[model samples]
Target: MPAWRRIRSLRVRWLVATLAAMAVALVLAGLFLHSLFQDQVMRQHESALTLQLDQLTARLEFDASGQASIDPATLSDPRWGKPYSGLYWQLDEVGAAPESQGAQRSRSLWDDRLHPEPDSPADGQIHVHQGTGPRGVPLLLVERTVFSAETPARHWRLVVAGDLTEVGDASARFARVLTLSLLALGVLLALAALAQVAVGLAPLRALQRALTDLREGRSQRLQGAFPAEVQPLIDDFNGVLDRNAEVVERARTQAGNLAHALKTPLAVLDQAAAPSVTADPAALAALVHEQVTLARRHIDWHLKRARVAAAQRLPGHRTPLAPVVDGLLRVLARVHDARHLDLGADDMPADWAFAGEEQDLQEMLGNLMDNACLWARTRVHVAAQREGDRLVITVEDDGPGIAPEQRQAVLARGVRLDEATPGSGLGLAIVADLAALYEGSLSLDDAPSGGLRARISLPATR
Candidate 1:
């Protein structure tokens, strides 16, 4: 894949997105902080100049002629006495002729006069401006108009000009420091984002490793502790693995059972066909027919098991208990009409449905109800109800019941309790195996009517 397409990894995507957002935030924050710092620095500088203007105004002495003069020595700052020392003060008469000089200036101005931008200020109010100072140095000027009663017809403008080189240097240094600080912060935040993405996705990494182990046959199922957010997915995958393993085991067992079951019938057929075992033709034919029937029964039993096993995992399968039970009861009532057995189903909710193939449910219930009808004297009752996510079905008969110890044996293949009981002894076994394939169970218990009770639990669906 191309490099851009390769960016589909979640870790890379999260890191890139987080770092980009942090970068933008840090850049904006840096700009805002720098602007605040510059404003504060300029305000402090202007305040200092305003204080100088106030002191210069305070020292002004006007003769009775309204000529403004100031003694430079009275100023506390020594820079006022040095020429071009980056700090200076001057006085100008308001509305004076452009060529006339009626004011005294600080010696720091030397032979150059402070020609600030023309602006009018109210008396005692300071107005700041930017202008060129001695030697063309950039300057911040704080100017204020003063009115003295000693010269009622005239107002004096006192100005303090300071060089901006120092402020410029300070601002530049601040910008450099702020840039470095934000860059460092961005780097640190990026690292933290990377770490967070790694920590958050660690469970997925562990899951990948577990899948690798399972694929390589190192483990039977996905096995590990994960975060709560990911544990459900892990559990579901493990469940799938468990079910697959069970299917494989069931297939192997069915093959073995089928082979073992057909062995006796096939051996008998082979003996009847042997040359030294010649017998009457009719007897031999009957023997072959019986053996073939037994073999076919075993085959059919294994085929049914395989079919149920395959359909057990299918989704969205629903068979209502009411209809299947009612249908089976009606069919059995006629099949056992000679005995006049009362075959009937109890009233069950129509919504009580099995979570499996309808045919499999029919097969299981058919075997159970038929076996009940065979043992029933006059009454066989089928009952079904929902218990949580399971459907419980019971088949009861009012006849001679087997001892508790023998009930289990009756559910084993070909383990007939009585040879006189006309059956292949596979009915109860098939029902038990079918129930097991659907992750259900079958048990033989005592009925309320003093007969056998066969109860089966199957998965239910709403």
Candidate 2:
């Protein structure tokens, strides 16, 4: 049950396989034990028959009448008890009737009808059968044919029987013993299997402890002994940690370079204005404002890049895209309040996600929507939806559409296609940079509203 978590593991599967194989071996061992015990029972039964035969051999003798007879008194013995008293013997001379030997013999011989079947082999060894005896007690019977060495005419068959009840009782007891023993063995094997599973999973528990230590900020890398089978997995995990650290360092370096690269131009543009003219409230303020806005745009672009880098290393609940785009339209409406434009966020699937940092998403959509607000005279529409593995956000307004040749130049850094346009023209360039940072893209196209449509696409993740 503990293994049923989302972090699926192969350890449980391996343990189950080991248990199954052990179970098979135990079953086979029980079978072997049964076979060995059964063979022992058969040998004891044959030994009883051989002992009865040996006694009859000494008792067999010729009387003065020249007839064969057995001394019945010899049948009684201390070692030979109840069921062994069930033995029978028959002796017949040439052309004469048969005579019984034992007092407690089968009543079958009493019938004088007690006759050995001809089907018995001449070699005379133990043969198993079921036949009625004198008392009508069902019997498990053993028979043997015999020959006398002194007289060839003495060809006799010795048939032995024991009560079926005694044999059946003995077998039942043996079976009960075997069953109980096998059951005990199965329980012991099951416990052994459980212990093997625990021993085998010990490494996994150690690995978990190591990872927990890492989460508590105690260790940066896991180093512990593990079975050779898991060595590759540990090595691969270490490699991932190393790569993540490298990516973090590279992101910081690139962020610093971006800040330094854009500051020099803003400095020069500021120095170009004279101090007396810069002191003029209207004209100099406008010049300073434009340059400050350009510098802010560069800063925002790099900041978005840094946020995207951080989010890649640690993903959480997906950032909702519909609300982010909607919020941007509302703020853009407030920014261009004087124009009195009607901005509506088009309905999109609410579950669409951007999968990047929430603030970076806000910056990307805010810049695009603000640009739409700047150019539109009456209406601006923003919407986002998914296509395949990408989520596409499009902002459209009823403004002059970009000429086919000018669309490419509009995305270039510091390339303002329209000089009369009030701003520094870095908005589109910054949007393009942020898009690239998240492995996304931005494109310019004709809008259905008779204006430019800025479409931005970001990779979709669940």
Candidate 3:
């Protein structure tokens, strides 16, 4: 089939939908958690920078010329004295000439001056921003404007900054771990979804097997207690089977009643036209006899057709081939004993069964074996075997076989061969018709023993 159709199956659709939903949820959660963690980390980093700026403001001093400077000796972190330690402090003279450079900054700044934006914070207020620090590294800067005691007339922009590369590395590491963990969880959940689908739909698989058994004649109805969700379906199917069996039984009774009803009148007509009635009644009696016989034959033919068609669909019909063949051989052997015919049936597997009623089996096999016995010079052999879902039965004899060209013609009802054989020519025709009703076939071919071989094929028990 096509790829789309295969994917559209219930199990596949269930697994896809569940896994898709989980993946989306995991992705969104990962993003939200990562953003929350980054925000908290940045907040903590800013608080530390604020504390360092406060200390820098405390350490602010001026030389004898009113120039603001920081006493590096008073700072707690030794990195403030180390160049490019990723932690630095700087002071810029505000409200000074645009061309004037800032006051001396912490030793860590070296030649790189802290560039405070023109919009500096109000006196004693703080402004936090991210910008380039010494050596072009990213920094989180906290700047505060203060009028130092020694230089009270001028506002100095005091700044303390820390490098952000370490924090960024930490965040990146966290994101990678979070993604891997969530992906692992998703894989586990996908497998759980598959298992859930299989468990949830297990009843459906059981129901399918039960139906198959019913069709194959291994069971009469759906057997086992199903879940409540599926119990009603099984009940309805069993009800349908029961009703179908009832209907077929009714049809069988009606066909039997019809045969008896019609045959009685036909027999009466034949009796009424008997030669004992009058010497001149020969011609009239012959005509009446012929018509009565035709009516009876037609009635029997149609009744059997109707009965077979009705019973073919009813469930729980299995006839063992070996038993039926054995019975037929015993009866026919006695019936044709005076002809000294060698009649026997080959052993077939015990499980070899025709998927139909016993009467139908008897009917088909009887006609074939009887025809073989009638024409056989000495021996009539019968054998049966199973071929896949079909049963194959062969009846062969050593008598003169029908010519290939005329074989097809003999299958027609009332078309007797060899006027002296004393048959209505309906045996093979009836067998063929019954086999066709069972969705089977019958064929005539040359036998291994120089006689005709009649092969019948019918649906077998699964």
Candidate 4:
């Protein structure tokens, strides 16, 4: 499918939009939380360094010569005496003192010193910064300038630094855990969104199934409870169906009434024109008879067309194939008892129904059976079965069969293969017309009994 079409679907669009929103929310939240945690960790680490700087300043001692010294045993943390232990302090003399004048360090400094910016600080002022410790390790450095309590003229720069690698590791660990936690949350929320979409659209699916049933003549209208959002549409659709059925019924009534109105006058005219009683000119009598016959044929054709137009599209009309065929066979057997033809129908399942009017089904089956009885020398066989959504019916006779080339011509109005056969030649044509009206088909083929076979395919119930 095209990307646009996929997005056009309501379910897909809902899922994509919701998940996109969720993903963006999770990403932003993760970033904000990571930054917050990192800042808090850094502040706590810097606080510890400041406390250490205070301790270093408190232990500082200076002589009148501006020299400073510190005893290793005075420090409380053992790392103060351990060389390159990542926690260290240093003291340097300021103002007129030689660069190497009063350089004293904690034992942890070993042979290296912390290199901070060369900026002087006011007396009793404290500064914090990032600097490099011994061996190029990253450090958080806190420095203060203080005059010795014993000698007011002696000033010393006191500095303390702590390793920053632990803070970095903690921040990195927090980021990884936060990303995983947020991703898991996204997955769970995505599933919830999908389930919500399915539940929300369930009514539309039910409506679709109901429409299918209505179209296939399975049920008359939409049924079952629906959400308020969709209930109005269902009610409106059912109203349209009702109006459609009403219109079709009205048309059928008009067509039947018109048929009766026209047929009565035509019948009277046909009887009046008959030559059984009065002997008018023979030529005039024959002319009147021919015209009356033509008029009658025209009337029948038009009336049948009108009836078919009205009947074919009416939904929710089903007639069982078995009962219709059985009833026809019973009537045909009695009607053709003199011929002593072996006429019977193969059993059809009760569920096989014609998705059309019962009268139409009777007309179709009655015509086909009557034609078969006329042709069959001994037996006529009728059978019906379902093929997919179609009902397939076959009527065969064990008599002289129609040639393949002539079969198509025989279905035309007023066409007959044998003129001697007493029929209006419109039976097959009417059957064909009604079948076409119902969107069905009829074909003639050779029967297995070496006779004619008539097969019809029509819509069937589910």
Best by lDDT: 1
Please provide, for model 3 over 42-78, each residue's C-alpha lDDT reduced to its tens digit, 9 standing for 90 to 100.
9999999999888777777777667778767788898
Q: Kindly report which residue stretches of model 3 are placed more than 4 angstroms away from their true locations once superposed.
A: 1-5, 61-68, 148-153, 277-462
The list of candidate 1 runs beyond 4 A from truth reads 1-6, 62-69, 90-122, 131-136, 149-156, 181-213, 218-236, 275-293, 334-341, 418-422
* Residue ranges of candidate 2 with Cα displaced over 4 Å: 1-31, 34-44, 47-256, 259-300
Model 4 per-residue lDDT at 98: 54
For candidate 1, report its TM-score. 0.82
Error of 4 at 231 (Å): 2.0
Instruction: Write one digit per residue (lDDT tens) for candidate 1, span 1-462.
Output: 678775997777888889888989998999999999988999999999988877777788888878778886687899988989999888888998866642568888898878877788888887889899878899998988887687778988888899999998999999999999999988888888988998999889999999999999999888888999898998898888888888899889989989998999989998888899979999998999999998998898889889888988688888888888888878887898899887877799878899998888998999988988888888999888778999999999998888999988999887898899898888888889889989999999899999999999999986
lDDT of 2 by residue, 244-279 (tens): 887778677877867686677567665756464335
- What's the lDDT for residue 127 in model 2? 64
Error (Å) of candidate 4 at residue 455 is 58
Task: Please report, as a residue range, the 10-residue window in candidate 1 with the lowest summed lDDT.
Answer: 97-106
Error of 2 at 118 (Å): 34
Q: Rank all candidate structures by their lDDT, best first, as comma-separated numbers.
A: 1, 3, 4, 2
Which candidate ranks first by TM-score, i.e. highest? 1
Which residue runs does candidate 4 get wrong by more than 4 Å? 1-7, 65-69, 94-102, 120-125, 148-155, 264-462
- TM values, all candidates: 0.82, 0.51, 0.56, 0.54
The lDDT for every candidate, in the order shown, is: 0.87, 0.71, 0.85, 0.85
Candidate 3 — worst ten consecutive residues by lDDT sum?
A: 97-106
